[model samples]
Target: MTLIDDRAPASVARTIAGISNGELSGSTCAPELTEGPWAFDLGMPGYGPGASQGDLLPAGSAAQGELPERYRRASGEELSSWIASAKASLGSRVAVMGHFYQRDEVVQYADFVGDSFQLARAARELPDAEAIVFCGVHFMAETADILTGPSQAVILPNLAAGCSMADMADIDSVEECWAELEARFGTSPDESGRVPVTPVTYMNSSAALKAFCGEHGGIVCTSSNASTVLEWAFERGQRVLFFPDQHLGRNTAKAMGVPLSTMPLWNPAKAGGGLSGEALDASRVILWNGFCSVHKRFTVSQISAARAAHPGVRVIVHPECPMEVVDAADSAGSTDYIVKAIAAAPAGSVFAIGTEINLVQRLAADYPQHEIFCLDSVVCPCSTMYRIHPAYLAWVLEELVAGRVVNQISVPSRVAAGARVALERMLAARPDTTMAA
Candidate 1:
């Protein structure tokens, strides 16, 4: 493994993506992002300039390329002290946001921890906040940046964290697909003649993809609001072309009573429209070729194995899984919906779940008496989401207190305005009672 260039942010970004994907693996002990000590935590007060945002190693910070003595300890008291001091040194503007699947240690400091949409929503709500220390992956922090104001800086604690699912849909491929689609669908605007096509992408995509959607009357979506987003597309186009995660599109449309016959698969490598009538004409949603690697690991064999070993078991999965897997399962929904469903399930009932390892383990730990285990009995997490560590959180916040900033993520006025229009359409379609997206 190559030593990460602490100098080039771009190089660091690539290292992060590679490390998370298991393409570059090594053992390094230094806690690159850990902040400061607790006694010094209460040293500074709210918004008082002291340390710069990019100053990961403030003057009083521990020696470079080494873990702080405080962080190396086992006690929560020690951990708390380090976090508190880091918070103090960073100033009052620091806010740590954790995803539901974050490790317990990282989750310990999250001011707000939730699903991706929830985190983005929180970042948007705190427009005036000086720094958003995201305890998730690069894509998530990027999403937060798009939602927040320009002045407010967004950050990922660990530079190594990145999402594989998000990576599957690059801007170049989407652009290429769009060029081909226009030839097949007719470039004339929707029925109202306002736009040629209403492009809707899953929130898991890059900002560039979102920009593509925005530029072409497109919007973004999470697992929760996919249905509404698709319906919004229907109003503007003859058909909906969804991407990256084929299972999500298939499962969501199926739930809306979109017949399987009406839905067709779109193989990116295949030539021309990659589809035709009966399959295309009968279709309500056209799915992309991408899929979630982690979700794909969960299989029907695992589900059956669990059922036979533990009778009266309930199996639930995310929409990212294959249709055959979903078909054999008891139910399916987004992370938020999954949480609610499991919480509502009767106590003592065993559940075999198919999703990220961190979430399933966290759920199992959260709910005792009720036996809960992952559909796949393996130790795995979304490699990208695991990137942000507590040290990074402290570093970003410290920079804010010092009146300097790093990784400022903000959608431009033009892109944001267009994106907002697409987003509003999806939001409006979803009734007030449902907040899954």
Candidate 2:
């Protein structure tokens, strides 16, 4: 079915109110919205935001399930009015930070928009802002929470909007893996000299994991600064255990000429099976066996197909893809890099993109003359990111205005101290600190 043809607006609209605030799974709330009208629109490569496309759904109708019981069913005009009122109500006390790949609906409310690391910095820049509404996933809010003061609280509109990539590694699993790594690899202790190993958790991980990194000498890193982070690790330790996403570690290491054999995958399900004799001996950068499902769907076959179908199609992908896929693509970088690459490209060029569907579709719409296509033929998106619906956004902001203040994500003081140490170490070590915003 055509992406537009399959959209059941009534079904999607009804599902909004039906969803529980904190519940994410189909069992808990809206019966796992696996397929819907919005999902259909996502299938259309390069289909942009509703407001951008002039398809803003009619608001404040007599229809019962179209909107919440409390507020007037909002039209584009009403939506605009509510946003203006919210800003007026909060004034400069509330600072909204949007992730680079956020949908236009959420991004529209952002006072500052940037990548993960830049968003962290953005939060610090607004230390005085009493409330920081983060328009990203759970971990991003956690990062903002850690970076900001105790006076401020970080809020996620949809509490369920989490990154599966982050979930792939937890503090428990990581601690277990590290104990095994230390016993097996036997790294010399860090600067404090008591701890045997350095735990370098990616910034895309949970705050608890960051606290673990902080408790140990491990630092947090994003796609933009993984190399600088690794360099710092090498100066301090014999080997670095990188977590959550493997491809990020591999690609970053490869760029620095660390041999593939040196990078071993740590599988949590396997007790001791993860450590091959060669893997332990040959490795410098140990990678956890995890991936971004959204990026994993972008195969070499899709790249080949896009190349054949649209001659001269420039291919780009996130570094979270496997080495073979990164080897095949024309370019690879963070989400911001992908957008900027397309923006700088000549108008006539055909570009095939690999990333989250929303950002790719948004790019295609923005650059209409140039043919832009997703690397995957099958319609798929980052399921975690899909949790942030417009209705949830409106509800969260309204709750803030009502003074109820639901879903405030705060990092524990001990965790924040540890996490801050790691983050500060990263910023100090990095020579060229410029990152995408």
Each candidate structure's TM-score, on Cα atoms with residue i matched to residue i, is 0.77, 0.80
Model 1: lowest-lDDT 10 consecutive positions: 46-55
User: Candidate 1, residues 405-434: lDDT per residue as tens digits?
Assistant: 654555567666666655545445552225
Q: What is the TM-score of candidate 1?
A: 0.77
Off by over 4 Å in 1: 1-80, 88-92, 189-197, 273-282, 410-417, 424-437
Worst 10 residues of 2 by lDDT: 55-64
Q: For candidate 2, list the clashing residue pairs, or say none.
A: 26-32, 60-73, 199-218, 262-283
Note the residue pairs that clash in candidate 1. Answer: 33-391, 34-391, 41-85, 51-402, 52-399, 53-399, 158-388, 161-387, 162-384, 262-283
Give the candidate number with the greatest lDDT.
2
What TM-score, to 2 decimals, does candidate 2 have?
0.80
Error of model 1, residue 257, in angstroms? 2.4
